[model samples]
Target chain A: MSVLDSRRGGGNGNNDDLASLEAGLDALETHLDTRASRWRKLLSATWPPVLAIVGLLGVWELIYRSGVKPTYALPSPADVGLVLRDQLSDGTLLEAMGTSLTRGGLGFLAALAIGTPLGLLIARVRPIRRGIGPLVSGLQSLPSIAWVPAAIIFFGIGDAAIYAVVLLGATPSIANGMVSGIDQIPPLYQRVGKVLGARGLSAARHVLLPAALPGYVGGLRQGWAFSWRSLMAAELIVHSPELGQGLGQLLDFGRSNNDMSLVFAGILGILVVGIAVELCVFAPLERRVLRRRGLLVARS
Target chain B: MTVLEEQRVTRSTGAVSLRGLTKRFGDGPNVLEDVSLDVAEGEFVCLLGASGCGKSTLLNLVAGLDRPSAGSVHVPGGRAALMFQEPALLPWLTATQNVELALRLRGVGKSERRVRSNELLELVRLSGAGGKRVHELSGGMRQRVAMARALAQDSHVLLMDEPFAALDAITRDVLHEELVRIRESQQLTVLFVTHNVREAVRLGDRVVLLSSRPGRVAKEYPVGIAHPRRIESPEVARLSVEITDDLRTEIRRHGAH
Candidate 1:
């Protein structure tokens, strides 16, 4: 309102009344939301998942006590918890997680490096898209575990083989995510860029890339899922003394030793890691991008 | 043809000149057919037509966003800046950043871009809203930011395709005045496209009516109305009625055939 009054003074006095009227209209029309405190918002969001977990544990305890299976096979929740504590005290669980996460992180970075340019090429170059678009999508559906045997033959049972499977698993999803992201950009943006004299590389950098970011982030999330799954599959299959233990290898060890509690602990570790990464990294990133664009409505 | 030949054609034309410009998509009929018009230096011309009359298409051709299938568009003023019905600001950038982008693309240095963008924002009376995101601004304010971005292009010819059509009546009136004030101070040659007859009459030096379905230039009316003209003024109302009658007749012709 003050800005409006200030603008009124300098302009032709004939339109001063009109300027003040406009300021009034603008102020009256805009609706401001009163947001809740941050702590309250966090508590509201966290309660549902916490309740669900507790309910699931209750069900699990009931099943264990039903005596439907032998004690060795149907270990109680407390027994599995004890196994987890034992592994934690010995530092083996931490080591296993560290190794698996390092591999997953490095493998995902590689997939991202390869996928971005490939996706851009497919999205933009008509001939390239026509030639390889189907092939890339086909790769996504073909399961990276199916490549383990070929990867083993090519690179042996080592880090290279594991990384190969991870890349093959995640790269297509990432690339496809990128392609879909670019496809969804409204044609209006491109026209605006052209009018602003942003041609070729400049258009891609400033206009196309930022506009396609939400979709690209979606792809990265899917790609991470694929990488994690592929790494676990490879780790379970390709165990060697030279290669350190991972969550998948730990599960394989438990099965061989017939320790049901250890096997459950390994499964829990894998699930926790996956969910934590999603909640901490991808969900927040996607929410930020969408919220800034006014695509996400703020829940009261 | 060659750049030399292109430069020669532009030199002989007005700020913006169209010579028999024809546009078509694939095998479909021409969207615009043999349409010709001109806007002298610092002139404001409103192209008035009904829906599907190719008003937007003509602006696209003039803005060089689309090319004509035949004939030429000569803009001696270099590339024309276009404003759409929607503000079309990038949602992620703040208002100043959006204006700065146009300057950056024009090869302005970093330090100069900042200063110039602030000046442009002030010109549109959006100085305080420079750091606000696109979504945070009201619809009318967003359009003002859009105007700032367009002005940052420094193009002599400004092509507007119903830029005020989406606004509320009061806001639109305020903007109409803002546009006129800006046009005068900047000495901009404006080609505004709108279907509202009164709006064309209220703002333009001349109103060009285009016939629908192949979009030919049907007629032209030069407004002798004085400046500071109100949208509800008697002269504007009389001209709007005449233009509306002609527009209805033009639309009826399509049904007869």
Candidate 2:
């Protein structure tokens, strides 16, 4: 086709100048840093979750006022609020939260220390990956509640029993995270790493780990859930005077005393803490990693 | 022996020597049958043929991405870096980091890597693209980044496997000029692989045609054309037609029982 008729983008300019202009335009327009505008973007992104929480509270208030059951069976939202207020005023709520947080935190840290390397080993070495891969999945599927009885027998109903349960619950998730992360890494990236002389330890450190990070982070989130659940289970099932009373103990105590409002408060506290940690910690950490690599998209 | 050690011994300037280079795949038919060719130091050589002619297989052997089944292949550099048809830059890294990665692997010091990566990027005329991610770049820009990445290896020999095959004609033309400029400036020994006879004629100082399946070198033509030879030029067209005729005969031979 003649130059005049061959117009892709119009205006019959000099070919060299036009080519350079087109190249510059292509470079500028398709560039990676198309981040949203600051304040408005953040506000828009946060509105949905904020609204959901408010709507949930409204529903709870509505259910409370309906008076569908006896107070012993289903306490009103106001009754639960009163218990929460009393616990907060007395400092018991803080103490229980601290106790549970310490146990879960310690267990998770230990799981991370043990499980990350174990998972890397399992992911990298073919024999170990095959041998223990299925077993790890099996462990993940087994509930932390089921471990409480065996753990008590093994460690005799003390801190050891609690820790044993936590270990059983959290380790699988951390290891599975590493395995899945490693598995999810594209073959091309590995090949590129190899081409770049990234062999053995260097490859794992620079390419494999970073490439597999998203999956590993996913694993950590799941592992935290397991750690939290297992610690609560242990606290409920294996009671000891030496061990400080935690959220789980408070929950059990509330149930025994037939204080349904206090029981609802404990349940709400656990859920609120879980959701809070996920939203405030893991979600931000994950978004930063994904955003740096230009993989993150605003959640609708 | 490693391709690097072989390169050093033959490093009388810029020359690639492959002797009795036979290759096979796991008890199967030989892919390359006792093939041998010598590419002069500072010469742009294109291995021209149709698919399964073992053109890429030869390039891989020379690149040290693979080893030949038998015989010796020597590039001037102990290590010869490669550019694939696809711009295989790491998606996670920006253009500069992709190039710097090669320098990093080569044990280039942390202080020197940035300087060297920038220099190489500038050499490819992508000076200001240090911070650009691979996915953000256009097709031609991506190839230039790939070129920069390959050059970062600082090897004497550069093996390219159809590096411009995926590009549009205009971009490919621009890159052809860029390649010639880079080769002239750097005094690089390029072992380029392509099925496009016109591209072969346009780019190479010499074109080596390979016969199909169990590929062997069928003919070698020294283009004798000056640099910046257009694809439409009479010499380029004449040589391209000659190479195409040879390539067709090889394909016809494959069909003749």
Candidate 3:
């Protein structure tokens, strides 16, 4: 009986024996996975999307070659790729990318600056939460495109109008993301934080903020998407010498000239930029947070 | 107020005092009522109760996380380390950082923090596990790491709310041994909460039972058994039966009403 009893009486000074017994306990207990490989993980993540794009391209080429719309009405993949090649060689593609990216970047940054505090306040302060919770939720569902005309009316045909459209479109999504994140934190964590003497600012910074990060990041991803789309809509509507030519303006110009290949190229630009931003910036950030916390499930 | 009590208090300063402690959330029925107990420095007391008996509520008050509706809770020290039924380790941090958070909050110097954290990890027999994330730990290991984290706070009084209840039977038994071993070495005053009859007898110097529905202390039993108690031993099993019968009667009263 004493042999099975791992706890020794005080003053026995049998720590070495206890440690060995605990070693035995550790050996019997199920151990968690020690590591997950990086490259295999990357491959598992990389293959499916690559295959999907290939499948899509194959279908698209078959339809185009079948003369479904008599070629001029809708261009072939080769025709779009040729236009892409010409634009890249002429530096027009890079110039347009710079213009659109600058607008989207500034717009998203503005939304982030305003929405983060608004979210923290709404999540923590009961009065503000009661005042704006429904409104924030309502705005989140409102399409960013609706803000285009209103932004034009307010700021007129300029970069200011484009920026305004992006901000209006994305702030609520960013703010609401923080709100839900804070709401979802397990109550036990808050209690533990309080017990550890973390009160007021210390509690919010150390406990509330980190705990709400995943949700906040989700908001940022949605907000970025909204900002980019709204900027495009605004660019399509407004034209100014100072605003410079962007991807949206290029698409609009293509429509006016009735150049189907140019239009397809514009569409491709928007689609590629959106996917690239998600893949390069937000997706990796979200994954890092999830992976560190063990919230991310490993894919085969 | 007695001379003997005052002398004892002076001899060992860290003690938890609850006098007429009561709690009711909002306009709901009382969660705990008129609970009074005193846990002396280095004493091990187990709080045993039926479901909804507000043993957790009592702990929250004792740890200063909640205000009692009536009466008071006084601690000799300003802080007491409290652990939940869940390990409640922050998923974002590795086990070492989880322990380090307590030390950081306590204002331990940055350079010394690592040494102290590793020492505490070793104390709980989680030496190499310090680098592991909370999710990378098994149930028992997480609880052990949590114990290490709780110890990091350097509080003399450790309040545990059924810290091992979620583990497997064998694992729980192993953790019980770990708890006893750690408590003995650290000379910690522990108020462990458990619903397990055998565990209450197996670990505590004294067991206090709470009746449900506006939980109040209904009974108390002292276990003078020697340390290294096996959960399945005959003496422990016998004491558990007696405590379980009393606990059942206390629970039965709520149903009778």
Candidate 4:
């Protein structure tokens, strides 16, 4: 029997019409996701990471309660939390965070400015790339933290030293990232680019840069890490009144005062800032790039 | 001798011409030798040969993607559009945007690019698929998008190197038909490379057969069949069989060494 005939209830046109209407509605509703349903799907996929983070927190609380170490050696999690609260109430923590973030951001920007052209030159010009390719890779392999002592000596223990170390640390990563980005581009793209009349600077701007964005962005992320680490090392070693109090200084203060809780709080503050920048700025930037290229998939 | 000179004269009028063209890697024997030919305006020619016949090398020379070791190559009409066996679509671009990139490079205005790209996509029977990314497309659809991108340049000549070789039989047949329709409608000049004798006969006005190893033009067939010719037609089958026989002979000669 036909779907309409089968749906007909015994001597009841109203019920039969209702049944057909319900079936049609069901068909229409198929593949449509309500907001709640979409959220449920997202939660299922994300739950594992959430649970692991909670488990880590639970372990920290347990260790603190068990008094694994003397309170002076490693304060309880509650003590650390108390330090964080005090700093927050006094606004010192936020101020220190702002100072560190500003320095890191500026250093990262400077590195990008220097590294991008260096990368493009290495990628496009054979002699230049050959000469500097090995050097860039070598520099990237060199620890940025190693630059701290030299920077202090050269720049005299202040913001200048911090910036110098940050620059040295970050530049190589950015340049190397760009080199990889350029290398990964398919040769076919170059051919197509040339045929389409893209050459010289115009070609670099329109084709090469966009194609290499993922790799370049990856480099930028590494550069930021380098900048942050170098700046912190510099701030810890070089103390000056002219240099405003920052996370690194706070960390130094906690160490000198033998305040383990303050040290833990400072460490947590650094971690939070780094993750926040990546999430709010770089992560979104990368996601937008991938999404524009249709490379992003909904987790669900 | 006069006929050869006349052929040379006719070739000189074409957008692309290759004269005594030969290539070799290092001290090896020539991959192509004395390959003198001219593609007249709006001519649809096919380079038919088995693997290692240097068909791609010749097309590359014509495209200026590579250089010939001997003789000369010329493109009287700027850069030619090249279509490879693979679609070679940019993974980052949508089907429409890919075509638009060609136009954008050609100095087309932003407003004009969108319309032109859409038009080209429609030309390839891929209307409403401009938003589809390259990887999302099927092999045939990708090739068609590739074709649209090639066409976006408005180049006088198109060099295709086994563009349909990887597709299924049905898809290839469909594309072959689509190509004929587009070629006729646009008055496009095509230099198609393929090993399929039937494809060579079906698509080309002239088919140049090349021998293997130290490739040279073994034979040339002038396909007199009209547009929309059927594969099952007596003329197409006859030419296919003849070309296949020549190709077989060339292969057997290579084996004797």
List clash counts for every candidate, in order.
0, 3, 0, 0
Give the top-scoring candidate (lDDT). 1
The worst-scoring run of ten residues by lDDT in candidate 1 chain A lies at: A1-10
Using DockQ as the measure, what is the rank order of every candidate, best first? 3, 1, 2, 4
Question: What are the models' TM-scores?
Answer: 0.94, 0.89, 0.92, 0.87
Off by over 4 Å in 2: A1-29, A298-300, B1-14
For residues B40-145, could you state the per-residue lDDT of candidate 1 as single tens digits?
7777899999877899999999998888999899998788999999999988789999999999999999999998998888878777878888888898999999
Q: Model 1 over residues A1-300: C-alpha lDDT tens digits?
A: 221232222355666666677677667766675789989999999999899989999998999888898989989889999999999899988889889999999999999999999999999999999999999999999978899999999999899999999999999999999999999999989888898999999999889999999899999999999999999999999899999999999999999999999999899889988998999999999999998887888765
Error of 1 at B213 (Å): 2.4
Candidate 1, pairs of clashing residues: none
Which CAPRI category fits model 3?
acceptable
**Candidate 4 to truth, TM:** 0.87
Runs of candidate 3 with Cα error greater than 4 angstroms are A1-17, A24-48, B1-14, B26-29
**DockQ, model 1, C-alpha based:** 0.36
lDDT of 2 at B169: 84
Interface RMSD of each candidate, angstroms, one decimal: 4.6, 9.9, 5.1, 16.6
Per-residue lDDT over B78-187 for candidate 4, one digit per residue giving the tens place of the 0 to 100 score: 88998989898877888888999899888899998988887787667677668877756777788989999888888878999999999877678767866765675565
lDDT of 2 by residue, A6-110 (tens): 221222353345447546645654645555688889899799989997898888777767878766887766777888999989998878888888898899999
Candidate with top DockQ is 3
Better of 1 and 4 by DockQ: 1
Better of 1 and 3 by lDDT: 1
- lDDT (tens digit, per residue) of candidate 3 on B173-233: 7788778877866768899998998999999878999989889989889887776678889
lDDT of 2 by residue, B9-76 (tens): 36645467999999999998989999988877777889988888898888878877788999999875
